[model samples]
Target: MLPLFPITLAAAALFAPAVAGAAEPQARALQPLMAAEVAAGAPGVTAYVDDGHRVWQGAAGVADVRTGRRLRPTDRFRAGSNTKSMVSTVVLQLVGEHRLALTDTVARRLGPVLPYANRVTVRNLLNHTSGIPDNATPPAVELFKGDPFRRWRPEELVALVADLPQEFPAGSAWNYSNTNYTLLGMMVERSTGHTLAQEVERRILRPLGLRDSSMPLHEPTPSGSFARGYSLDYDDEYNQIPETLRDVTAHDSSGYFAAGNLVTTEADLARFFRALLSGRLLSPALLAEMKTTVPTSYGPGIRYGLGLFFFDDTPCGTLIGHGGGMPGYENQFASTPDGRHQVGIMRNYEEAPDAVTEAQGTLWSKAMELACAA
Candidate 1:
């Protein structure tokens, strides 16, 4: 999980077959477009796109700076809060099964594990209106820096900020909090007779055949053709604090848990989004509920749904999905509601200059536009 100031993975089993398109030919324009970002001094990058018929994957820069390993599209990443979307999906599945309800209060579900549980509904946790403060506090990060491999239990994550004041009254305002999803993760485990990872695997991963995607509940770092993530100081606005780079690829992932402890490749991530938006994951009514929107502090026009983000003004006609990163890796992905177009971007470093970040966003937007048109 890229740090809430310092804090804190998706989809299905239907269309997880071989690639339909030639990657290089499909990404001709996109290749150089992303290459320019690498030229602009960003770290190694990997990406994937699906335009219904064909899929394209591309990469630039080194996955391992020490060895100068070229980043590959198949490499896995520690996708941070993007894990919220999956956790929320499992919760909604439970709801569909009559095992859980959106209106069920935390107090009703977790039974007073939190002070405001009675007032915070399951919907609140999914939509970030729970008013619960985040647990990925500055101190936890400090502890992480001291011992990057320290294991964390789900309960310990919530306890970190449990005593703090509530962010707001339940269902009153919107604030992104990692703790909400952590509770939902706990709820998933308790409601199902299995761990959160097992439930996700049973429901989403295995069915979708997302071989490259995993909930590494125990692994500290990724293996295989994985890109190494690095860290640097960033200002409140997330602009780079120059000259503060640190290798941050190794760390225990339990702190992120369901909040965002996914390890997946760009193609696998894009495939899940494609299946999800194409109406392969859930019932129509539940999918609609997932896309239900509430205003977010990201900006006046920006909005969030239950574990899903609404990019209403995007190039691909209101693409809906999520993005996540922690110290070493960042990922952003979205697809049109009908799943006609999709894109997944992977980055190996954080806190670049504002221009670089904006440029990356623009290029990403263009990639989606190109993918849609292709």
Candidate 2:
């Protein structure tokens, strides 16, 4: 049961206030919940919920710690690994057009430049069944940690892990590897003879009218009024070395590249996932293929599909969307199986206090409540 507050829906809409001028009661529960997250140690949080008819959004805490600027729901933030879904959508569209096949080996598609490319399949890359180890090794992190504005070439990024031992034999196990999608991005570029950003804009963003989203090729910061991302700069031993957070909003997302370089707002993310799940983005057959699940090594009740995740054991029954993390942001967007109800949440700080994670978990529970109600 939702926490009964004896307030009417309209009054509830005023609980945290809405950003888009009008507020929905369905979104009321999130405002204070987000506030609690901020109080618990998150620098800021912005969230939106679409309950079929209208979209309601809320923000909590500061966008910048230096000036103490309030975070707004309208502000854009890095979507992080959520970019994978957009990339996968473009790849699937090509597959639908008969330009590529999921079974096509990476070596066959890209001419076997990398040693492990021939052994990995396109489908393996999409579902993370490929044993490509993540490229964010300690050396890479040490090299880039203080130099956030450095531009990284895609080949250089892929070369970091191409020669490393596989995490497991291809298709034998599951481990989340950003390198898999980075390779997929290369494949998309090779297959289409266009940049991955160009293909995504032409195929997904423009078609969906996601005006607030973009693939940041070299920009280190989001355009417009964007939240300033922060990191606690914890060490490998989980010890807080600096005892203070650093502003990381200007870090070059080009390092993440096709794996997680997307800059988007909560509303735009909600819209994209809604369209993807509604059969408006991919064919019914491909959409089904996209939803086919393999156990994500992350946790139980969570399964990785081609590019999306299915959470069936949640209070909202089955919902599909992906959660993303970068150096300074942790975000999630989930929608009902049929795309009727959707929610997105963003926290502007990573490596935050444990209480922040607990507060965010509470927000997830609230999201389930809102989705189930919808």
Candidate 3:
């Protein structure tokens, strides 16, 4: 199933054959698959597709369930953990500049942010091998449910789990934790004396000509045109509350800061993925480092590289991107290893039922099948 992977990205290009500008017929087939997600209980869905040559976009369902306005390809989203890939890009860029080294420990950059900082290297954090414990557990979710609008700072997020025990010794095993990225975000500011947003803007957004993308760090909802987000409200006990489907479009997400708060459109995300995997965003040697992966606990046969994920055994082969989700939105994007075919899907609702999740998975597979078609 993982026919091409656990191999170098250079060899991967040989398998996928430089994907860009999908065929028109294959591209047009996505609109209906998007509609099927709405029929399965999603408030809305939007997507983007690109082969090296042409770009296509489609959407179905309503942006606002109450107002019944149609979702559009141009709508913005809180691109969740996808922010990790961008932040990882900057960290690697710093590595290429000789300003930062993967071997550098967190304590070297920010003195003892965690009890075990000295032992945790920058590379460990990037690949989720830092042994940092995640604080965003069910109980923490309960805390936020009490005051969904309560404002939080990055310091508070770090402090929330500082005393917790490590998952394992650094580099001994793999566990995904938002705390790793949050610290790296802090290190970026400490190293460059610029906000994470500024670095992302100058180094990534501006350079790639991605005008529709912006990192609104502390803001709850994205500015300009964005789908009003909604979620199936549940208690900390995982019980569906009364009137479960509620609008969480403005919940304060400062806690998600570097880990999940970047906002952009489907089209912008598609371009970012294309440019990144095509080696435009990172130097060849550094890009190879970004793609060097290890197995993860998240799923079977799947692997995680520094900031990206290798989704093994998919219809389109291994997809190299990330997925971000919070209370009210879900964003997933990926591409062929060669950057020849890129796809992104953004929807307004989050935490759907199993039936719906399965349907969404089907939607993704079908879309990739079309995307990888000859």
Candidate 4:
């Protein structure tokens, strides 16, 4: 049976606190930050910022249009690849203890189960230069869509990707493969003799006192307060897909595994990012290693370090973060160099206008400028 927290629906009501009573400037600034995506056709969005001392959160649109439930800042949503950052933290902690080496080959740990295991190393997986084919690519998509609720084992998911040809020779270049982190998840399990969820709870979540974050494997509802996810359904003509409530509980956690399978709130996510960047989660050396960059062409200047991306914006300079997308959700969390400021944003519908990313970039730039000014 699923372990459901007994918090009442009234407790969930705590999220809709007196927004009307908020200060005028904050309320005014929040309007564009929350509605920009939806104005571009996104169904809903929630955003939060942590300015080293206090937090600001705002929400727009509906969480469940079918039920007329409004979006809330406290709502929980599947964090997608943002899960990789958290998993990398646990792996680095293991590295700190000498339980594993960054250069350790997978063959030594996974044995005959993995065909090309001999070629990939722990560092390769963390930085996503593994060359391993992403299991979430093709045939696996069939399995996922056919039985969205299916619980997949790590080996099963890895085999799906392993059955495919390598994209490049190991470490020759960078390719973001879900397979890399799924294998890393297994590596964490084997090294610690505990499930990935348990290690996450023991090493990061519990220690940071993140009460609202959860690594739900097969369970649908979270233990405490959370948000409902929504998807857009389109017709033959290219138009805004009508927003429909989604059951994310059926999302195959096994497919995402360590790569992208955790649900959290904005406040908890901000806390985690702050802790990670502040040296509370990793040693200085490991954290430094985690922040170093590899080349990419996706944005102004894109680079991948261990499990996070470093974005170099003309106005904001360098910021560390990870962006994630699933069927009906998109999320981003970024922190400045000193870890004194951070921003997190989540949208319910997958298809938002290209302007959304630009707007996000603009918001980050403005937020940093304001923070630095203060």
Candidate 5:
């Protein structure tokens, strides 16, 4: 077993000021579970879960390993691929308002940019059925390794994968590709005559009063106090070069573009998903379309529906949310299908032990445990 960080002043800070639900006796266990995450090798972890009536926030581990600053429950972090849900929500909103159509082919909007744009439709892009090859090129990875702060344009990222062969015939099957969301971002820009960030702010953030959430674009650092992100140094082949961890808290997220560049706190994420599922965000018909899912490549019982993921077979009934991972950060979020219960989890360190799946499984089980409890 890995050495666990004791509940020092940094960890003890949470047990005092943390929110706990009076009706949720089981919710009190969240802190111990988060401590287990640190014992399992996560540098720091924060979790927030709301059961509609009560909200509980838990933190365990240091914000910085060197300085031993206690992790703030409100601290923001790179939301990574969680940005996909917001982008897709905006596009679907546009679809509902007659600004765009799901059947609209990418060629109709961006013919010159993507080689196979004609064969792919907006619906295909939203559902990851576009079969667009991923742009996570070796060169890009090398660049990330060499200079984590290197800025990138969405077009520049798209150009790198344009000439690559399609993963499969467009719309023939389901495949998770970051390239699909990249195109959606471009489409949003072309359709609205505004940047993706602007549209998201106008349509989602501002209306929901999610003051803590913002798309960082090329900005390498977040606005307020944030937990530092760390990852094990690895070579091109993902072979761990050393046991040492590198601080990647300020890594430029432009490389992720619209697909994974959103920064938000757990509260903001919960609020966004709550509003979305409670019928506040989209029309009934449109939200229904968003929930209609197909089996994903992730694993059995895990389905992908538009930008959201449906946990079909969890112990907590079924959940609807998404998971996001970047270089030095990762997050997991899930809520009941009706949005009455929700949980958002964050870990500062991206690298994991060989039992990464097991570590994640523990979190999933914990979320479900809290969700199903009294």
Candidate 6:
């Protein structure tokens, strides 16, 4: 029999800090939202809400089941596509510096290596209309299966999609291709002579003082405290793999790179959303440009903004934010139009079908209702 060990609580305590100034009224009101998320079967969750002056943060469930650890507010989790917002911020900073223009074609920066580089502009890549084939397609799956732990260079990863036929004519349509941002990552390096992580740090992280956020490239799973991810069980006859548990620390950040390779805590994410909505990262004009929408087939009433998603609210009001998922992680960060109130949630297990997405939308709606009432 396998030996059983009690999970450590020290890590949990170290990561979660006491709620600085949570008010009784607000904390009681947030109970429904937390209960809904927990009923959805999430192993762990962290939520942060900022209503102008004071910030309210809460956590529920477990971060590491094997260690019997509970989720903490400060525990870091994969941000998945939330990284795009950060990347876009850096790109916009370069524009502010006059180092690169949104109109510049990628080929001007990356040269002959990228197949559609000549046709796609920097703006197209940022908005996901470049029509570049997504690197996360079958070819990328094969590469990962063969060498899940290999550290990949940006160029080598770009080359994988460089020769693939364009998904559509450049700038003619929209598609959520990871390749666009992978190329954007390379372009950032080429244009600024700095890696994506370094550029993000200098332009956004440091300026915002987001101390807990990091762009770990091929590093081990996040240090200090974090949730352990699990895959659901499957039957062999059905070609289903058994539910397995593993330390997510060994996963390669290279595969995500600029597109989805960020790790951060809920408070850090709330800060990012708040700063972005407040126009701290971009000029007012640029922020307006970033919020403009382009039609896409992904969903009815769904549109793509520059590095953000535009969703029409029902009876409440319009909201903007992004959602991301990996094998074992799902996250959402959203805020109101005026940036007065923001909600961020991260969960460890991805096994729940559409639960995370549904919970996110529900949470956003609840937040909007609460904010508008106040």
RMSD of 4: 5.7
Superposed model 4: Cα runs more than 4 Å off: 1-21, 24-26, 138-144, 233-249, 297-300, 351-373
Give the TM-score (vs. native) of candidate 5. Answer: 0.91
TM-scores for the candidates: 0.88, 0.90, 0.88, 0.85, 0.91, 0.85
At residue 119, what lDDT does model 3 achieve? Answer: 95
Report the lDDT tens digits of candidate 2 across residue range 153-180.
Answer: 7788778886788888899999998888
Query: What are the per-residue Cα lDDT tens digits for candidate 4 across 1-374?
Result: 11122112212322332233257444456566555555554445676756556666777765654454777778888788899999999999999999988999999878855677888899999998888878865422432235665788888888786666777888788888888888889999999999999999999899999888878887745555455554443333434433332334345466678988888887787788889999999999999999977885365488999999987762456778887887557888888877777777787655434565465555555545543333
Q: Candidate 3 — which residues are off by over 4 angstroms?
A: 1-24, 51-53, 138-144, 236-238
Best by TM-score: 5
lDDT scores in order:
0.75, 0.79, 0.76, 0.71, 0.78, 0.70
The predicted structure with the larger lDDT, 1 or 5, is: 5
- Please provide the root mean square deviation of candidate 2 (C-alpha atoms, Å): 6.8
Q: After superposition, how far is residue 116 of candidate 2 from its true place, in Å?
A: 3.0
Per-residue lDDT of 325 in model 3: 82
Q: After superposition, how far is residue 62 of candidate 5 from its true place, in Å?
A: 1.4
| Candidate 1, residue 364: how far the Cα is off, in Å | 1.2
Indicate whether candidate 2 or candidate 5 has the larger lDDT.
2
Model 6 TM-score relative to the real fold: 0.85
Comparing candidate 1 with candidate 6, which one achieves the higher lDDT? 1
Cα lDDT, model 2, residue 317: 79
Q: Which ten residues in a row have the lowest lDDT in candidate 2?
A: 1-10
lDDT of 1 by residue, 1-374 (tens): 33322211000111121222434554666666566666555566666777777777777766766555666778888888778888888898899999999999988877878777789999999999999998765423643345667778888888888788898998889999998998999899988879999998998899999988889876767777677776565555545556444567777778888888888887777767777766677778898899889999899657899999887766676788899967677789888777768888877776444544665786687677766876
Q: Candidate 1: list runs displaced more than 4 Å.
A: 1-26, 233-241
Candidate 2 Cα deviation (angstroms), residue 5: 37
Candidate 1: lDDT of 144? 35
